[model samples]
Target: MSANAEDKLVIMNEEELKRKQREKLKKLQATGGNPRPARTLFLFNLKNPFRKACTSIVEWKTFKIIILLTIFANCIALAVFLPMPEEDSNNTNINLESLEYIFLIIFTLECFLKIVAYGLVFHEGAYLRNCWNILDFVIVFMGLFTFALDTINKIAGVPPPAPAVAARVTSQPDPAVRRKRRPIPLIPSVREADSEV
Candidate 1:
């Protein structure tokens, strides 16, 4: 209404705005200044510990394929190995061992990528809370434990028997691996044979 009253109102508004900004700045500073933004699954970046590329073979899609394949292969191996009624208790299958090694290599690459992605910022609590991240770590750790056990057993002059090879043959191919396999040639002989049958 009056010019003086208008001027006072504008000043009050500006002061309130400034106060709010100051409070926001103070809260930010108290939290160690500019908190890092939360990571999204699809739009992973260098700051995300779960997505750093550790090896030429360890890209995002490659890692995903590896994880899926590992699950499938492990399930198949377990099924094949578990049902066997081997006469000898000491006879163990080697298929499981090879699968385990493959899993270990993938996991090692994963963990290495994670370390590179996070660099020096990796926190144990954060690492534990992430699902895929934690699973990768666990897989690698279990492989390492198995390796240690095998090595110790060897050193004690009592090497464990190799697992049966059947598991390896029966294990399902990783989708990626299956795709890489050469497609069978469609020979006329095969076609004729099929037609006859």
Candidate 2:
């Protein structure tokens, strides 16, 4: 084809692609999806310096990796804490509760950053619009709620509740009593063997 014809063909293709995208977006919106436009709508003024900074920070790959690693570390800490004996947990130099609080603070900060970068729930591409984001939002609030309760308890001089495992263990029969119970024999007893003979 001639150069002019090629140029016209390319232009037509570009227009066709744009049309397809528009149609797809319309279908998505019709089905209750929040299809965001090329130009995003921010909760606050787009020109605000803090919001702009937050948007950049939230979009950075390193920031996402750091959050993922923090989650992994928190999971490892929980795993270590769960199987530990209640007695050993108290004597350990590393306080798992304090580690949990630190993890919660990091997650809460990440949540706030995303909220500033993307609008909370009103705008398209808002923080709470995605299902995963909604889960994170609920978890952060739950952490804050627990933190508040812990603080109140400390101020009121109320003791923390015992763990269910600790309570169950405490209620079990004494070790000596448990040891006295005879095991059921899989083989015939000597008296049974003599009678058989």
For all the candidates, what are their Cα RMSDs to the real structure? 18.7, 9.8
What lDDT does model 2 reach? 0.80
Clashes of each: 5, 0
Candidate 2, residue 48: CA error in Å?
A: 0.5
Error of 1 at 88 (Å): 3.6
Segments of candidate 1 deviating more than 4 angstroms: 1-59, 83-92, 119-126, 159-197
lDDT per model, in order?
A: 0.62, 0.80
For residues 48-134, could you state the per-residue lDDT of candidate 2 as single tens digits? 677778888999999999999998998888777744445345633368878888999999999998887787877667888899999
Q: Locate the minimum summed-lDDT window of 10 residues in model 1.
A: 34-43
Error of 2 at 86 (Å): 6.3
